[model samples]
Target: MQANSASGMAVHDDCKLKFLELKAKRNFRFIVFKIDEKIQQVAIEKLGDPNETYDDFTASLPADECRYAVYDFDFTTEENCQKSKIFFVAWSPDTARVRSKMLYASSKDRFKRELDGIQIELQATDPSEMSMDIIKARAI
Candidate 1:
């Protein structure tokens, strides 16, 4: 019985390794956007001195399978250096069907505008709500 259990464990490990190898060989790719310092400055400048705090800006959008937006912000401060916050936004597709799609600039707007592009067939979509963790994982 002990030998049989050991063999089962080895088989499981081998299956996992084979699955990983097949995943690596696939043509899976994710879109990457770099939030440069200049873009961060622009977004903050546009936001201005609003009464709302960072929490207010982080609220999820209330929409169906319509246009959706996501904001990612990072704050950093160093000794004797000015504190700064960076922001990025991504928009979802306009179709009634919920699915993940590539985002592109909708216009020359400085508000980090986003528009839907081609849809990724294998990507999952959350109609219940937009989740940062899920989006980041899928993007990766």
Candidate 2:
């Protein structure tokens, strides 16, 4: 899998981390996990195949204060036609119904922006440090 870097360099199997800025002042982030051999062996013995689906891995995750959503997105470019990077966005499930709605609204807003030709930049970054213009320019 080829990764698209802000510097225009290609990285293979790069782990993606994502963060979202919520209006409620709570921070949310997700990290793409790489399940190694040891974990796989253990899972095969105790649980089913962890590699089967993200849901399998999610089931193993210890319950936390937050809920979660695990999914991957395929990213491809003309220069990297031979491969596509699967970026995982593991969103924590919010217990508060209002906050849950807010999260959905934020995602909807992002999609709308993309449809309008606006850049969708959910970087693994401090919201204060993120520059929408810079992220938008990187797409070009």
Candidate 3:
């Protein structure tokens, strides 16, 4: 993981590894990430089971904190064919501190760059902004 001189934060090595597992191996349905302010590094906060619902994944995030996440959304296409798309989510809730939001905003690009094969990206400042409807719309 390379450190960003601007934010002084680096993504933990495991972030990319877990993402790869999700991408190539279907190991997890979703992953949540947080920046460890004390260590100044991004760390894996949680991993969702393969069968976890979107609600469960959303519940894992704190109501007043910022986070980064990747979700593997599986759905049937118009032809009834099964398909999956990987979504990279930047979750900076409105209630979170400005500094926290700023840190996440600054570090997001570098963090995302490390994970290869991401298909979609979402940036949300509220739960409604990242709802299932939005996910589905983006996947299409």
Candidate 4:
């Protein structure tokens, strides 16, 4: 993962790839929220396997200024490549602030402490602080 200080944005390419791999494996139900031009929040529940391709996932969403998203994992079926018992919600940076905040707040309540603590810490800290914190947290 990379964090660009000049832009005040964090990049999690590896994490994103891992997430996509997991999603493809078990077709998880996910919610994506746009945080900004270079930031997104994802949440998942009962993730099974990943079956949807990147193109397929992106195409399903409404075209907007959304550059980042989050989602939950659900169940996957090998026969049809169609996710069963799936539920997803998405938002973009251009989405209304009130709407986005409401969604985030609600999701946070629903997903309280479900995400890894390191991810939560990274979200709460600045870029410079993230690396050290992540390293320290991981060591423990």
Best by lDDT: 3
Model 1's number of clashes is 0
List lDDT for all candidates, in order: 0.27, 0.28, 0.93, 0.36
lDDT assessment of candidate 1: 0.27
Question: What's every prediction's RMSD, in angstroms?
Answer: 19.7, 16.7, 0.9, 15.0
lDDT of prediction 4: 0.36
lDDT of 2 by residue, 1-140 (tens): 33123222221222221212211111222222222222221011122222344344344433331222222222345676542222222223343345433443344322222122222333322222223343323443
Q: Using TM-score as the measure, what is the rank order of every candidate, best first?
A: 3, 4, 1, 2
Report the candidate with higher TM-score, 1 versus 3. 3
Where is the poorest 10-residue window by lDDT in model 3?
1-10
Tell me the TM-score of each prediction against the true structure. 0.27, 0.21, 0.96, 0.27
- Candidate 2 weakest lDDT stretch, 10 residues: 39-48
Using TM-score as the yardstick, the better of models 1 and 2 is 1
Name the regions of candidate 2 deviating beyond 4 angstroms: 1-50, 66-84, 96-140
lDDT digits (tens) for residues 1-140 of candidate 1? 01122112111132223223323432112212222222221111122122444335333322322222223222333454442222223434355333223222322132222212322212213332334444334333
